[model samples]
Target: MPLLPGAEPYHRRGGPVGVLLCHGFTGAPQALRPWAEHLADAGLTVSVPLLPGHGTRWQDLRVTRWEDWYAELSRELLLLTEECERVFVAGLSMGGGLALRLAAEHGDRIAGVVVVNPSVRSDNPASVLLPVLRHLIPSRPGVVGDIARPDAVEIGYDRYPLNAAWSLARLWREIQRALPRVDQPLLLLRSPRDHVVSPANSALVLARISSIDVTERLCERSFHVATLDHDAELIFEETLEFVRRLAPDAKADDHQG
Candidate 1:
């Protein structure tokens, strides 16, 4: 329940415009550090919280639910509002879903949003099987990958928690229902080869939304883990652009500085 050291407090300066960064499921702040550093360098306050039961061990995730994740992120958003006039939230995969949920619920308050490889619908056909395939997949203790960067965060168990995955499915359905209400500037950065989330899911949200400004950047090389992959720079630039537009006088030159 207490904040993990180097987890809650972000590396930032002078109460600049706030941007809360949430990492993917079963992942630690390591997955989001690059983005946070870039945002911080551009003079923004950034916080990338280690979600409940995350960053310690993969087993910790087994006991946590989606609500636990959302609650922590929402708390950070509320915190950002207290320090800065404009607030932006961004996430990857499961965190992406949470970001959108917050944006939808706090539509008018949020300045903008960015999401990468958002896992709204399972590309796995067995997801149709509901709370069963989760248990069927089984969680591997520590999975590693060959992402373009040297950074490697836990990929979570291969076996899905049927109930957890089922809950995610249900949450996605509800988020879909709330999509039209989000009219803030949004950047949906997705990977064409993301093995976890189908491109169609992003397409569906983009097509349905009526955001005052919307842009979809497609990463051609990386798989689902686009945050730490090659497209990360693109995500960073797009997010900088979003921040500049949403916050008064944030300027195009500010990001480069």
Candidate 2:
């Protein structure tokens, strides 16, 4: 399938510290491109994979499930582990849940985790009817471009695929169940005024995760797509700092020496 412009996955090789970025449901790598580039520019290797069924059309997503997305991310993590001494995972929205799952299942391999407005559960009451609704309707209006800055745009499908959404909900439940296994450092950034995801989602994750080093920060001016909103620079810089603190690149240190 031909990927939409700007939706192609991004990869850059840099120092011994690698970071893998995951975009949200219905979202392409474009949503997290700037953040990935920021880390890469700071001498950190980064990979932002376009999840299966994304970066093409909404119809494609309907045929895919959460496991496909998680599997792709897991593959990327394995590749990073092979090339770098330390690996960190980060994601936005549903991608955040995937990152958390990676930390939960591969805590020993992942150096740390960072999530922005991660969604483990939907705030929509209608989501409960998804299993049935998916059989009746194919899609609904999209939940993209929720940014505080008017000019910022998130590149994604204009419609929400019901079947895929149901699968995402299932992924959330799995993440919640495995939260106790996530013992690596966690940095969660949320938007208090997010219209797409509720504040309670982040609260639930912070309370459930077993990580002793957990930090929660607020993007006061951004919305759900905080990566492209007013606080985008904050997200980029904070994640870079988080990675540096957790896993300093030995290559850089040797160069300094």
Candidate number of the best TM-score: 2
| Model 2 residue-pair collision total | 0
Candidate 2 overall Cα lDDT vs. reference? 0.90
What is the TM-score of candidate 2? Answer: 0.96
Which residue runs does candidate 2 get wrong by more than 4 Å?
250-257
Q: Kindly list the per-residue Cα lDDT of model 1 for residues 58-101, writing each as its tens digit.
A: 45666777788788888888888887777888888777877888
Off by over 4 Å in 1: 1-13, 132-160, 251-257
Which 10-residue span in candidate 1 carries the lowest summed lDDT?
Answer: 140-149
User: Global lDDT of each model?
Assistant: 0.72, 0.90
Candidate 2 local lDDT, 31-71, one digit each (tens): 89889888888888899999999998999998999999999
**Candidate 2, which ten residues in sequence have the lowest lDDT sum?**
248-257
Q: Kindly give the number of clashing pairs for every candidate.
A: 6, 0
